[model samples]
Target: MPVISYELPDRFVAGAVGQPGERAFYLQARSGRRVTSVALEKFQVTLLAERLEELLDEVRRRGGDDAPVPAATPSELLDDEPLDQPVEEEFRVGTMALAWDPEGEQVVIEAQEATEGESAEPEVGDDDPAIAVLRVRITAAQARAFAERALKVVAAGRPPCPLCGNPLDTAGHVCPRQNGYLG
Candidate 1:
Protein backbone atom coordinates (compact mmCIF):
# COMPACT_ATOMS: atom_id res chain seq x y z
CA MET A 1 0.00 0.00 0.00
CA PRO A 2 1.15 3.59 -0.62
CA VAL A 3 2.01 5.54 2.52
CA ILE A 4 0.22 8.70 3.57
CA SER A 5 1.99 10.60 6.30
CA TYR A 6 0.02 12.31 9.05
CA GLU A 7 1.97 15.27 10.37
CA LEU A 8 1.89 19.04 10.74
CA PRO A 9 2.99 20.48 7.40
CA ASP A 10 5.51 23.31 7.55
CA ARG A 11 4.80 24.20 3.94
CA PHE A 12 1.51 23.77 2.08
CA VAL A 13 0.33 25.28 -1.19
CA ALA A 14 -1.67 24.61 -4.33
CA GLY A 15 0.25 25.07 -7.59
CA ALA A 16 -0.45 24.46 -11.24
CA VAL A 17 1.27 23.78 -14.53
CA GLY A 18 -0.06 25.18 -17.83
CA GLN A 19 -2.78 27.78 -18.37
CA PRO A 20 -6.33 27.84 -17.04
CA GLY A 21 -8.39 24.93 -18.47
CA GLU A 22 -5.22 23.24 -19.64
CA ARG A 23 -3.63 23.54 -16.20
CA ALA A 24 -2.73 20.53 -14.07
CA PHE A 25 -3.13 21.45 -10.40
CA TYR A 26 -1.41 19.73 -7.50
CA LEU A 27 -1.78 19.95 -3.74
CA GLN A 28 1.60 19.75 -2.09
CA ALA A 29 2.64 19.59 1.57
CA ARG A 30 6.14 19.36 2.92
CA SER A 31 7.54 18.71 6.32
CA GLY A 32 11.19 18.69 7.36
CA ARG A 33 11.95 15.37 5.72
CA ARG A 34 8.95 14.34 3.61
CA VAL A 35 7.11 15.96 0.71
CA THR A 36 3.69 14.73 -0.43
CA SER A 37 2.07 15.72 -3.72
CA VAL A 38 -1.36 14.86 -5.07
CA ALA A 39 -2.95 15.69 -8.39
CA LEU A 40 -6.32 17.49 -8.41
CA GLU A 41 -8.30 19.75 -10.69
CA LYS A 42 -7.89 23.54 -10.60
CA PHE A 43 -11.49 24.02 -9.51
CA GLN A 44 -10.80 21.87 -6.48
CA VAL A 45 -8.01 24.21 -5.41
CA THR A 46 -10.31 27.24 -5.77
CA LEU A 47 -13.10 25.62 -3.80
CA LEU A 48 -10.76 24.45 -1.05
CA ALA A 49 -9.46 27.98 -0.48
CA GLU A 50 -12.95 29.44 -0.47
CA ARG A 51 -14.26 26.87 1.99
CA LEU A 52 -11.24 27.22 4.25
CA GLU A 53 -11.77 30.98 4.50
CA GLU A 54 -15.40 30.43 5.43
CA LEU A 55 -14.41 27.92 8.08
CA LEU A 56 -11.85 30.32 9.49
CA ASP A 57 -14.39 33.13 9.67
CA GLU A 58 -16.90 30.90 11.44
CA VAL A 59 -14.28 29.76 13.93
CA ARG A 60 -13.20 33.31 14.70
CA ARG A 61 -16.79 34.43 15.17
CA ARG A 62 -17.64 31.59 17.54
CA GLY A 63 -14.38 31.35 19.47
CA GLY A 64 -13.48 35.08 19.63
CA ASP A 65 -9.73 34.95 18.88
CA ASP A 66 -8.93 32.54 21.69
CA ALA A 67 -5.96 31.03 19.90
CA PRO A 68 -4.63 34.31 18.51
CA VAL A 69 -3.08 32.95 15.34
CA PRO A 70 0.31 34.41 14.55
CA ALA A 71 0.58 36.87 11.68
CA ALA A 72 2.15 35.17 8.67
CA THR A 73 2.58 36.82 5.27
CA PRO A 74 2.08 34.75 2.12
CA SER A 75 5.61 35.36 0.79
CA GLU A 76 7.15 34.19 4.07
CA LEU A 77 5.16 30.96 3.93
CA LEU A 78 5.35 29.93 0.26
CA ASP A 79 6.82 26.51 -0.57
CA ASP A 80 10.14 27.06 -2.37
CA GLU A 81 10.66 23.54 -3.78
CA PRO A 82 10.37 23.07 -7.53
CA LEU A 83 7.21 21.11 -8.34
CA ASP A 84 8.85 19.55 -11.43
CA GLN A 85 11.23 17.05 -9.87
CA PRO A 86 11.19 14.48 -7.07
CA VAL A 87 7.46 15.01 -6.61
CA GLU A 88 5.59 11.97 -7.83
CA GLU A 89 1.91 11.98 -6.98
CA GLU A 90 0.67 9.58 -4.36
CA PHE A 91 -2.74 9.49 -6.09
CA ARG A 92 -5.14 11.46 -8.25
CA VAL A 93 -7.55 12.92 -5.73
CA GLY A 94 -11.23 12.30 -6.44
CA THR A 95 -12.83 13.57 -3.22
CA MET A 96 -11.80 16.14 -0.67
CA ALA A 97 -12.78 16.92 2.92
CA LEU A 98 -11.67 19.77 5.17
CA ALA A 99 -12.28 20.56 8.82
CA TRP A 100 -11.05 22.73 11.64
CA ASP A 101 -9.72 20.89 14.66
CA PRO A 102 -10.73 23.00 17.64
CA GLU A 103 -8.71 21.16 20.23
CA GLY A 104 -5.54 21.32 18.22
CA GLU A 105 -6.28 24.69 16.63
CA GLN A 106 -5.36 23.26 13.26
CA VAL A 107 -6.91 22.94 9.82
CA VAL A 108 -7.19 19.38 8.57
CA ILE A 109 -7.22 18.70 4.83
CA GLU A 110 -7.93 15.28 3.41
CA ALA A 111 -8.01 14.08 -0.18
CA GLN A 112 -9.12 10.63 -1.25
CA GLU A 113 -9.45 8.66 -4.44
CA ALA A 114 -12.79 7.61 -5.90
CA THR A 115 -14.01 4.49 -4.17
CA GLU A 116 -15.97 1.59 -5.54
CA GLY A 117 -19.67 2.06 -6.24
CA GLU A 118 -22.37 1.06 -3.74
CA SER A 119 -22.74 -2.35 -5.35
CA ALA A 120 -19.04 -3.11 -4.87
CA GLU A 121 -17.53 -4.09 -1.55
CA PRO A 122 -14.50 -2.16 -0.34
CA GLU A 123 -11.21 -3.98 -0.06
CA VAL A 124 -9.08 -4.07 3.11
CA GLY A 125 -5.43 -4.37 4.16
CA ASP A 126 -3.20 -6.43 1.84
CA ASP A 127 -6.13 -6.85 -0.50
CA ASP A 128 -6.04 -3.13 -1.25
CA PRO A 129 -3.20 -2.38 -3.63
CA ALA A 130 -2.70 1.31 -2.86
CA ILE A 131 -3.43 3.82 -0.15
CA ALA A 132 -6.04 6.25 -1.42
CA VAL A 133 -6.08 8.94 1.24
CA LEU A 134 -3.83 11.96 1.99
CA ARG A 135 -4.30 14.05 5.10
CA VAL A 136 -2.41 17.11 6.33
CA ARG A 137 -2.67 19.20 9.46
CA ILE A 138 -1.85 22.91 9.18
CA THR A 139 -2.06 25.96 11.39
CA ALA A 140 -4.59 28.75 10.79
CA ALA A 141 -1.81 31.16 9.86
CA GLN A 142 -0.61 28.67 7.32
CA ALA A 143 -4.17 28.32 6.07
CA ARG A 144 -4.37 32.07 5.39
CA ALA A 145 -1.04 32.04 3.62
CA PHE A 146 -2.13 29.08 1.53
CA ALA A 147 -5.39 30.79 0.60
CA GLU A 148 -3.61 33.98 -0.48
CA ARG A 149 -1.04 32.17 -2.60
CA ALA A 150 -3.63 29.88 -4.17
CA LEU A 151 -5.74 32.84 -5.30
CA LYS A 152 -2.68 34.50 -6.86
CA VAL A 153 -1.76 31.35 -8.78
CA VAL A 154 -5.32 30.98 -10.03
CA ALA A 155 -5.71 34.61 -11.03
CA ALA A 156 -2.42 34.57 -12.93
CA GLY A 157 -4.05 32.36 -15.55
CA ARG A 158 -6.28 33.48 -18.40
CA PRO A 159 -8.82 36.22 -17.74
CA PRO A 160 -12.44 35.19 -17.28
CA CYS A 161 -15.27 35.75 -19.75
CA PRO A 162 -17.49 38.58 -18.54
CA LEU A 163 -20.65 36.91 -19.76
CA CYS A 164 -20.21 33.25 -18.85
CA GLY A 165 -17.57 33.45 -16.12
CA ASN A 166 -15.46 30.85 -17.89
CA PRO A 167 -11.79 31.50 -18.55
CA LEU A 168 -11.10 33.32 -21.80
CA ASP A 169 -8.17 32.35 -24.02
CA THR A 170 -5.72 34.71 -25.69
CA ALA A 171 -7.03 33.50 -29.05
CA GLY A 172 -10.59 33.97 -27.64
CA HIS A 173 -13.40 31.84 -26.23
CA VAL A 174 -16.78 30.65 -27.50
CA CYS A 175 -18.94 31.72 -24.61
CA PRO A 176 -22.11 29.75 -23.94
CA ARG A 177 -23.69 32.96 -22.70
CA GLN A 178 -23.46 34.29 -26.22
CA ASN A 179 -25.08 31.21 -27.79
CA GLY A 180 -21.79 29.37 -28.39
CA TYR A 181 -20.27 32.18 -30.42
CA LEU A 182 -16.76 33.38 -29.77
CA GLY A 183 -16.91 36.61 -27.81
Candidate 2:
Protein backbone atom coordinates (compact mmCIF):
# COMPACT_ATOMS: atom_id res chain seq x y z
CA MET A 1 0.00 0.00 0.00
CA PRO A 2 1.20 3.49 -0.77
CA VAL A 3 0.32 6.01 1.92
CA ILE A 4 0.72 9.74 1.28
CA SER A 5 0.77 11.29 4.72
CA TYR A 6 0.86 15.00 5.46
CA GLU A 7 1.46 16.17 8.97
CA LEU A 8 0.39 19.80 9.30
CA PRO A 9 0.27 20.36 5.57
CA ASP A 10 0.75 23.81 4.14
CA ARG A 11 -2.79 23.65 2.74
CA PHE A 12 -5.64 21.18 2.42
CA VAL A 13 -9.04 21.82 0.93
CA ALA A 14 -12.16 20.38 -0.72
CA GLY A 15 -13.15 21.89 -4.04
CA ALA A 16 -15.12 21.26 -7.18
CA VAL A 17 -14.54 21.76 -10.87
CA GLY A 18 -16.97 22.36 -13.78
CA GLN A 19 -20.37 24.05 -13.65
CA PRO A 20 -22.74 23.77 -10.71
CA GLY A 21 -24.87 20.83 -11.84
CA GLU A 22 -22.04 19.07 -13.62
CA ARG A 23 -19.21 19.41 -11.15
CA ALA A 24 -16.59 16.95 -9.96
CA PHE A 25 -15.52 17.03 -6.33
CA TYR A 26 -12.02 16.45 -4.98
CA LEU A 27 -9.96 16.53 -1.84
CA GLN A 28 -6.55 18.05 -2.26
CA ALA A 29 -3.66 18.10 0.18
CA ARG A 30 -0.45 19.98 -0.26
CA SER A 31 2.87 20.37 1.53
CA GLY A 32 5.18 22.83 -0.14
CA ARG A 33 5.16 21.65 -3.79
CA ARG A 34 4.00 18.07 -3.39
CA VAL A 35 0.25 17.79 -3.93
CA THR A 36 -2.24 14.94 -3.92
CA SER A 37 -5.77 15.06 -5.29
CA VAL A 38 -8.42 12.38 -4.85
CA ALA A 39 -11.89 12.28 -6.34
CA LEU A 40 -15.02 11.32 -4.43
CA GLU A 41 -18.80 11.71 -4.61
CA LYS A 42 -20.46 14.92 -3.44
CA PHE A 43 -22.43 13.04 -0.79
CA GLN A 44 -19.21 11.59 0.59
CA VAL A 45 -17.83 15.08 0.99
CA THR A 46 -20.98 16.13 2.82
CA LEU A 47 -20.77 13.20 5.22
CA LEU A 48 -17.09 13.80 5.88
CA ALA A 49 -17.69 17.42 6.78
CA GLU A 50 -20.64 16.62 9.05
CA ARG A 51 -18.70 13.85 10.79
CA LEU A 52 -15.69 16.10 11.35
CA GLU A 53 -17.87 18.72 13.01
CA GLU A 54 -19.46 16.10 15.24
CA LEU A 55 -16.06 14.73 16.19
CA LEU A 56 -14.77 18.16 17.09
CA ASP A 57 -17.85 18.91 19.13
CA GLU A 58 -17.43 15.69 21.08
CA VAL A 59 -13.79 16.53 21.76
CA ARG A 60 -14.73 19.98 22.99
CA ARG A 61 -17.46 18.66 25.25
CA ARG A 62 -15.15 16.18 26.91
CA GLY A 63 -12.10 18.41 27.16
CA GLY A 64 -14.02 21.49 28.31
CA ASP A 65 -12.53 24.99 27.92
CA ASP A 66 -8.97 23.72 27.76
CA ALA A 67 -9.60 21.66 24.63
CA PRO A 68 -7.68 22.74 21.57
CA VAL A 69 -10.81 22.39 19.46
CA PRO A 70 -12.57 25.62 18.50
CA ALA A 71 -16.33 26.09 18.54
CA ALA A 72 -16.09 27.80 15.18
CA THR A 73 -13.49 28.09 12.48
CA PRO A 74 -11.10 31.00 12.91
CA SER A 75 -11.33 33.65 10.22
CA GLU A 76 -7.63 33.37 9.40
CA LEU A 77 -7.95 29.64 8.90
CA LEU A 78 -10.77 29.92 6.34
CA ASP A 79 -9.66 28.64 2.91
CA ASP A 80 -11.58 29.74 -0.17
CA GLU A 81 -8.98 29.14 -2.83
CA PRO A 82 -9.68 26.99 -5.86
CA LEU A 83 -7.85 23.72 -6.16
CA ASP A 84 -4.22 23.82 -7.24
CA GLN A 85 -3.55 23.80 -10.94
CA PRO A 86 -3.25 20.62 -12.98
CA VAL A 87 -5.74 18.86 -10.72
CA GLU A 88 -4.63 15.37 -11.60
CA GLU A 89 -6.58 12.78 -9.68
CA GLU A 90 -4.39 10.14 -8.04
CA PHE A 91 -7.30 7.84 -7.18
CA ARG A 92 -11.02 7.64 -6.47
CA VAL A 93 -11.66 7.41 -2.77
CA GLY A 94 -13.96 4.55 -1.64
CA THR A 95 -13.62 4.62 2.11
CA MET A 96 -12.52 7.24 4.60
CA ALA A 97 -11.69 7.28 8.31
CA LEU A 98 -11.24 9.99 10.91
CA ALA A 99 -9.58 10.03 14.28
CA TRP A 100 -8.50 12.47 16.93
CA ASP A 101 -4.90 12.31 18.06
CA PRO A 102 -5.14 13.30 21.68
CA GLU A 103 -1.42 13.48 22.33
CA GLY A 104 -0.71 15.39 19.14
CA GLU A 105 -3.96 17.34 19.44
CA GLN A 106 -4.75 17.06 15.75
CA VAL A 107 -7.44 15.56 13.58
CA VAL A 108 -6.43 12.63 11.37
CA ILE A 109 -8.21 11.86 8.11
CA GLU A 110 -7.52 8.93 5.83
CA ALA A 111 -9.01 8.48 2.37
CA GLN A 112 -8.39 5.09 0.83
CA GLU A 113 -8.49 4.21 -2.83
CA ALA A 114 -11.46 2.30 -4.10
CA THR A 115 -10.77 -1.23 -5.24
CA GLU A 116 -13.04 -4.11 -6.16
CA GLY A 117 -13.36 -6.94 -3.64
CA GLU A 118 -11.47 -5.04 -0.98
CA SER A 119 -12.40 -5.46 2.65
CA ALA A 120 -14.63 -2.81 4.20
CA GLU A 121 -12.10 -2.10 6.94
CA PRO A 122 -8.67 -0.86 6.04
CA GLU A 123 -5.79 -3.32 6.32
CA VAL A 124 -3.57 -1.87 9.01
CA GLY A 125 0.19 -2.16 8.33
CA ASP A 126 -0.45 -4.10 5.18
CA ASP A 127 1.95 -3.66 2.27
CA ASP A 128 -0.32 -4.83 -0.51
CA PRO A 129 1.00 -2.20 -2.91
CA ALA A 130 -2.39 -2.17 -4.63
CA ILE A 131 -4.06 0.01 -2.03
CA ALA A 132 -3.27 3.71 -1.94
CA VAL A 133 -4.15 5.95 0.98
CA LEU A 134 -3.99 9.69 1.54
CA ARG A 135 -3.61 10.52 5.22
CA VAL A 136 -3.54 14.04 6.57
CA ARG A 137 -3.11 15.36 10.11
CA ILE A 138 -4.37 18.86 10.77
CA THR A 139 -5.24 21.05 13.73
CA ALA A 140 -8.83 21.28 14.92
CA ALA A 141 -9.02 24.76 13.48
CA GLN A 142 -7.97 23.53 10.08
CA ALA A 143 -10.45 20.67 10.27
CA ARG A 144 -13.26 23.11 11.03
CA ALA A 145 -12.26 25.25 8.10
CA PHE A 146 -12.13 22.21 5.85
CA ALA A 147 -15.62 21.10 6.88
CA GLU A 148 -17.05 24.55 6.29
CA ARG A 149 -15.55 24.74 2.82
CA ALA A 150 -16.65 21.24 1.94
CA LEU A 151 -20.24 21.94 2.90
CA LYS A 152 -20.19 25.10 0.87
CA VAL A 153 -18.77 23.23 -2.10
CA VAL A 154 -21.51 20.65 -1.88
CA ALA A 155 -24.19 23.27 -1.51
CA ALA A 156 -22.84 25.19 -4.46
CA GLY A 157 -24.37 22.66 -6.81
CA ARG A 158 -27.76 23.04 -8.47
CA PRO A 159 -30.44 24.85 -6.55
CA PRO A 160 -33.28 22.78 -5.12
CA CYS A 161 -36.81 22.96 -6.49
CA PRO A 162 -39.26 24.90 -4.36
CA LEU A 163 -41.96 22.24 -4.50
CA CYS A 164 -40.17 18.88 -4.32
CA GLY A 165 -36.80 19.76 -2.80
CA ASN A 166 -35.01 17.96 -5.63
CA PRO A 167 -32.21 19.63 -7.53
CA LEU A 168 -33.49 21.86 -10.32
CA ASP A 169 -31.86 21.33 -13.69
CA THR A 170 -30.65 24.09 -15.94
CA ALA A 171 -33.27 23.13 -18.54
CA GLY A 172 -35.82 22.61 -15.80
CA HIS A 173 -36.92 19.18 -14.64
CA VAL A 174 -40.00 17.05 -14.20
CA CYS A 175 -41.22 18.15 -10.82
CA PRO A 176 -43.00 15.42 -8.88
CA ARG A 177 -45.08 17.88 -6.93
CA GLN A 178 -46.42 19.22 -10.22
CA ASN A 179 -47.62 15.75 -11.26
CA GLY A 180 -44.54 15.07 -13.37
CA TYR A 181 -44.92 18.32 -15.30
CA LEU A 182 -41.74 19.95 -16.51
CA GLY A 183 -41.41 23.01 -14.33
Give per-candidate clash totals: 0, 1
**C-alpha root-mean-square deviation, each candidate:** 4.1, 1.8
lDDT of 2: 0.92
Off by over 4 Å in 1: 67-75, 78-84, 116-131
TM-score of 2: 0.93
Window of ten residues with lowest summed lDDT in model 2: 119-128
Stretches > 4 Å off in candidate 2: 123-128
Candidate of highest lDDT:
2
Best by TM-score: 2
